[model samples]
Target: MVITYIAGPISGNIDINKQAFLNAADQLQSSGRVVLHSASLPVGLTEPQYMDICFAMIRACNEMVMLPGWRQSTGATAEYYYAKKIGVVVRDFNQTLKVSR
Candidate 1:
């Protein structure tokens, strides 16, 4: 099974971010892909700490699925670039969903 990391904004409107991640993760799981979403990251961690954890998860995944508004997030952007640097497949959430559906 393909392991996909879900990267998106989490600083602003956390509820919306969490919901979006959950919905996308559900769809991805239904399609038989293993998902690593950051929505459940422990609260109260510093930005650097969060990124450290997220980057580790990214390294473990086979690919990354970037959600809409990811460009506006520093953490997501870092994940994107890191994934590129390490040759991990990077996909857009909408495109992945379209292909799966």
Candidate 2:
């Protein structure tokens, strides 16, 4: 099974954004992929610290699932590039699902 980390805009719009992340995770899990994501956004943490966590998860995973609107997020874009730099496969979650179907 492919291990995947979820990356997307998550700084604001907590309810909506978290749901999108969860949905992406569910979709990937159903497709037989192991998914890693920050399911809980801690109450107080520096951006760099949070990014470190994200990067660590990405490193542990073999692939990354970029949720919709990933381009709008600086963090998501960083994650995408980092994955590329580390040779981790990156997939647009929705697009990947469409092609799989």
Misplaced by over 4 Å in model 2 are none
Pairs in steric clash, model 1: none
Q: List the residue pairs that clash in candidate 2.
A: none
lDDT of 1: 0.92
Most accurate candidate by lDDT? 1
For each candidate in the order shown, give its overall lDDT on alpha carbons: 0.92, 0.87
What TM-score would candidate 1 get against the native? Answer: 0.96
lDDT, candidate 2, at 60: 96
Candidate 2 local lDDT, 5-96, one digit each (tens): 99999877878999999888888888888889875667588889889998999999998888888899999999999999999989888777
Give me the candidate number with maximum TM-score: 1
The weakest ten consecutive residues by lDDT in model 2 span: 38-47
Q: Which ten residues in a row have the lowest lDDT in candidate 1?
A: 37-46
